[model samples]
Structure formats: structure tokens, C-alpha cells
Target: MTQPIRVLIVDDEPLARARLKELLSEESDMAVIGECRDGNEAIDAIGRQRPDLVLLDVQMPEPDGFGVLRAVSREYQPAVIFVTAHRDFAVQAFEANALDYLLKPFDQERFRLSLSRVRERRRTGATELDAELVERLESLSSRLTPASERYATRLVAKVGWRMRFLRVEDIDYLEAEGNYVCVHQGKQSFLTRETMNAVEEKLDPRDFVRIHRSLIVRLDRVEEVEPLAPGEMVLTLRDGTKLTSGRSYRARLQRALDLPS
Candidate 1:
């Protein structure tokens, strides 16, 4: 008989950790070796226990899931299965070369699929994993966490040597101003050193949409989207703010509205 695969479960949420442990216990071929409630504990447990597999949660207070991975010594690294609640990070997670990602509230079949992949890797020999791939995965994992969360919920900007935290939600729109990005909220405007593209990626897609190469607007704040002459379009916000839609983004705006055009 083959040796059972050893597994460790890591998550800050008690119920989530308990549910995963219960699910793994149901598998005859897998054994639950340990459980951890935070990334720091996960790092310590993984180094001490050296489980063959780890079911890791992406979001946790301090030293999050990615931090745990970073702390793992290359000689004792285990196959990782990332568990996340938000879909926004899926693309980035895959790009990190994660063995698999199981969205929260996963079913038995999905868990089985992830297990199968781990088994295949174990059978093939863990040494076969490319070193470059591991490094790239580490890099991508570090980048996967939203910048806003990494830095601060709000950003501090320097206006003539004065710095202040601008609440992210208060911003009406983001605009590219030369090398800097201008943030407008109510009657206040501030010039931030961050680029528009970087800011766009960090903002929640559901709340903010890029209307033009240089502009991103808050969706809930938008009051109306009007078709302009020929191929052009314009959007009006609840604050009576108006922004023009670029040709490239017209289809996206239409899809959001469920409009035929």
C-alpha cells in the first residue's frame, strides 16, 4: 500500500480551518498532520512538521499566506494549494504557478481534483520542478496581494512637502497628469506619484472601471452613460461629473449595462 499523503491546513478563520480539516479527514489516501491559524504559525509548523501538502489561505493578518511561502526553505518546500474567497486574484494566483487554487466553499470534486494534481507531482518527483518556475512563482505571489492592502487602506500624498492620507473611497475619479496621477474627490484634488495603470489594478473592478487610457471612474457613482456622435460615448455620475468613454472601452461599458450596442 502507498503511504498516505501528509497534509497541513492553514487559515485564520476557525470555521474555515475546521471545515477543511474535516474534508481532508474524509480522504483515506490523505492524512491531516497539523493545522495553523496564521501565516507565522504556518511557517513554524511547516518547518517543524514538513507536511507533503499545505492547504493555504490567501488572506490573513500580517505575514499572510504569501509570507508563509516566502519563509519556507527551498529544501523543505511543500506542494501548495491556495484557497481564496475573492475571484479577482485568480489570474494572479495561477500566474504564480500555484499547484492549484480552490475557491472558498469548494465541493468534494474540486478538492479531489487538487489532490490528484499533487499526487501526480509527488509520483513524478518534486525535484523535477524548475527552479526558475519556483522563483517566478515567489515573485508573482508577492505581487498578488493588493497594493492597497500591502501599503495602507489610504494613500498619503505630498503637496508642497505636506503629506496626508487620502481615503480611497472618497476619490471621485483618477486621471493621468503627466508622470503623476491626479485623484479628485469632491472639491479636493491631489497629485499622487503612482501611475494610473498601477492604481487601476489595485482598485476593485466592480467599483471602478477604466473608461479611457487616462481615466478610471467609480461605477456606483455613475448616473448615466450616453452615446455621443458616431462611435463616441459619455458617462454622467451622481455628482454631476462627466467623463468620456474611449472607443476601446465602449464594449465593456455596454456589457456592464446589458445593452445591445
Candidate 2:
């Protein structure tokens, strides 16, 4: 019989680790070798245990999920299934790069789907990490500025055959357009194929705030905020443009503006 797939679970949350351990217990084809609570323990476990797969958390303390990959690339490259509670561009980055991930609070069906994908890849003899995988992870991790802890001050977008660089401060607001984001700056607008949450990760939270699920505006550009109704507000921009805040995002908008929550 084939050996059970050796797995390592790494997450800070006790409940998260327990849930994963519980789920893995039902899978006869997989075996739990160890569990880690932080990046340091994970790094050591990955090096010492040499598991076949690692369920990693992106929001862990220093040497985060990406850092763990970087540190292990030179020695071992285990199949990774990111188990993250992170609500940011990182999730989209992983998806866009074709990496498997299980967002937090995921249902059992979703969890099974992720495991199935990993199993399929292993069956196809494609379990090894390739150069492209490393590059993809690097592309997302490169945005992290440890010195400043901010992602980026400028964004590079594709415009037809040309590339455009838009500084974060120059942007008035961003709108979600299906699988893309339309960035408006004064009279010009540029479109990029990225999720709003992903784009939000590239911005400074103090400088920008999401007013709606579909909208993110520069805090300085907001001229006036008017209450429309319960859990709704209309914001007028400095350029006379008006946008309404989403009910779900009302509390966040209020907190961003230091209003009574």
C-alpha cells in the first residue's frame, strides 16, 4: 500500500489547529506528523520533520506564511495549502497564482475540495514545486516592506500595450469591475485585473478606506459624509463626485473616520 500523505498543521489559533486536526483524522490517506503554532516552530518542524504537505497560516507572527516558504525553498519544497483568515490581497494573489488555499470559516465541502486538489496534483506526479511557484510567491511577498510594513506606494497597471504607474496618493478612488479594479485619478482612469481586497493590501490604511464593498476612496479626497439612512451614508468627493457606502462596510467607514461606531 502507498504511504499515507504526511502532513503538518501550522496555525496560531488553538481552535483552528484543533479543527484541522479533527478534519484530518477522518482522512485515512493522510497522516498528521506535527502541529506548529508560529513561524519559528513551523520553520523548525519543516526542517526537522520533512512532511509531504503543510497547512500554513498567512497571518502568523513574524516570518509569516510567505517567509516560511522562502526559508524552506533552499532545502525542502513541500506542497502547501494556505489556511488563512487574512482578508486581503494575499488570498487573491494566491488564487491568481494558482496556489491552493482554504479561507478561514470555510465549510467542510470547501475543505474537502482543497484536499482533493492536492490529492489530484500528487496523483499526477506534479507535487513538486516548480520555478514558477517560487516566482509567484515571491511576487506577492516582495510587496511587503518590513521597514515600513506597508505594501506599496505605487501600482503598475497594464494599459493596452503600455504599462502605467499610478502613485497611491494620486488615486482618487477605486471601483470593483467584475474581476478587475478601475482606478480613477482626476479625469483619467486605469483598469487592472485584480480583486479590490487585493488592491487594498497595496495601500496604506491610514491614507485609504473602503467605503463600500465595491468602493475604496482616499481619505483626504472625502469632502463631506452625509447620513442617508440607517446603516447607509453618502460621501461627496473633493471633485464633486458622490458615492454611497455599503451597509456591510458602514461600521468600518465609521471607524476609519473616527465616528461613533
Candidate 3:
């Protein structure tokens, strides 16, 4: 007889895990080998258990689902089916080339479809991570969390094994750093893997303005705006730090600040 497919379920919520377990139990060719409560535990389980498939939750404390993927050794990584509560992440999840992205409250039919895809991939012996999938997942790092229609009032960031929460009001400015965005608050800055555009979309436009391609400044933090040559301008924050506004962004900045030209 062929061996059953080994599967590991990872989710922070007990009910979520239980639900997945119940759904997966109906599959005769799949076996639940292990389960994890969070990203760190998932990483260890993935490395040690070496399951054939992983049902990973997108939102978790600190490391989260993406963090677990990043932490796992390439050789130990398995085919992933991302289970998210929000449909907003569907685009990014599929872009990462996951076997399937299941939105929360999915019925048994949907669950079976996801499992079927994994089974088909296994039969085809296509399980290796490719360059395009890696790049897409890397791009999805920051957008995974804060996937809601409501504006974000706080931000979640990972520092080592711990997760830090920063209120939107506490942020003084934001800077784009590669795949990450540096969240600048009083006397400190924390990095999150989300892109500037993603975070910007979550922020209230009335409270922040993008003065440069890489910069977003809190409106209340602006101390002065000095015009440079032609369309260029310099923005001085309350803390005395200066940021140059892109020539193309000058008019938008002016409109945001309501400055008469």
C-alpha cells in the first residue's frame, strides 16, 4: 500500500487547528503527523517532522506564517497551503505560488480542492521551490498582515523572537528599506517586512503624506517646509531631521500642507 501523505497543521488558534484537523481527517491518503501553535513551533516541527505538506496560517504572533517559511531550512520546506482569515491576501498568496490559498470559513469542498492540488503536485513529483516563487513570497512578507479594509490603528513588527506593537499615532515617519519598511517612532525605529505602499495604504491619508518615493512623514510631525531650486523642496521634521521631497511630489506635498504656491 502507498504511504499516506504526512501533513502538519499550524495555527495559533486552537479552534482553527481543530477545524483543519477535522476536515483533513476525511482524506484517506493524508495523515496528520504534527501540529504547531505558532511560527517558532511550526519551524521546529517542519525541520524535525519533515511533513509532506503544511497548512500554515498567515497571521500569528511575531514570526507569523511567512516567518515560519523563512526560518525553515530549504531542504526541509514542504508544499504549503496558506489558510488565511482574510480574502484580501488572496492575490499575494497565489502570487507566491502556494498550492492553494484557502480563505477562512471555507467549506469542505474548498478544503478538498486544496488537498487535491497538493496530491496532484506530489504525484507529478513537483515539490522544489523555484526562483520566481521565492521572489513573490519575499514580496508578500509585508502585506500578509494588516489585511483588512479598516484602516490600521497599530502595526505589528518582529524583533528577534518577540513581536512589538506600535500605535499609528506613535509613528513619526516611515522609510522604505528594500523589502522592509523602517517604522520611526520616538528615539527608536523598528523594521517590518511589509512594503512602503502596503503600509501607506493602511495609514490614514489625512495623517500622513508621501513626500518622496522612499519616505512617508506624519503630517503633525512637520516643523517646516523649505523650497529648494524649482520644484524641489526640503521637509524639516520637528526633531530637526530633513528629507528632500521629490520634484514630482512637490505639488502633492503643497496640496497636503495647503501651502499657497
Per-candidate TM vs. native?
0.51, 0.51, 0.62
Can you rank all candidates by TM-score, best first? 3, 1, 2
Which of the two candidates, 2 or 3, achieves a greater lDDT against the reference?
3
Q: Which pairs clash inside model 2?
A: 89-198
lDDT of 3 by residue, 142-248 (tens): 55534442356777677986768789999999999997899999899999767787778668888899988899999999999899997988888999888899988
Off by over 4 Å in 3: 1-16, 26-110, 125-148
Task: Judging by lDDT against the true structure, name the best candidate.
Answer: 3
TM-score attained by model 2: 0.51
Question: Which prediction has more favorable lDDT, 1 or 3?
Answer: 3
By lDDT, is 1 or 2 better? 2
How far off is model 2, as Cα RMSD? 14.6
- Model 2, 167-193: lDDT tens digits are 887999999999789999999999976
Local distance difference test, candidate 2: 0.78
Q: Give one digit per residue, the lDDT tens place, for model 1 in 71-146.
A: 5776677888888886655555442233777888889898888888888888877633344544554456557766
TM-score comparison, 1 vs 2, better candidate? 1
Query: Which regions of candidate 1 deviate over 4 angstroms?
Result: 92-98, 128-148, 151-261
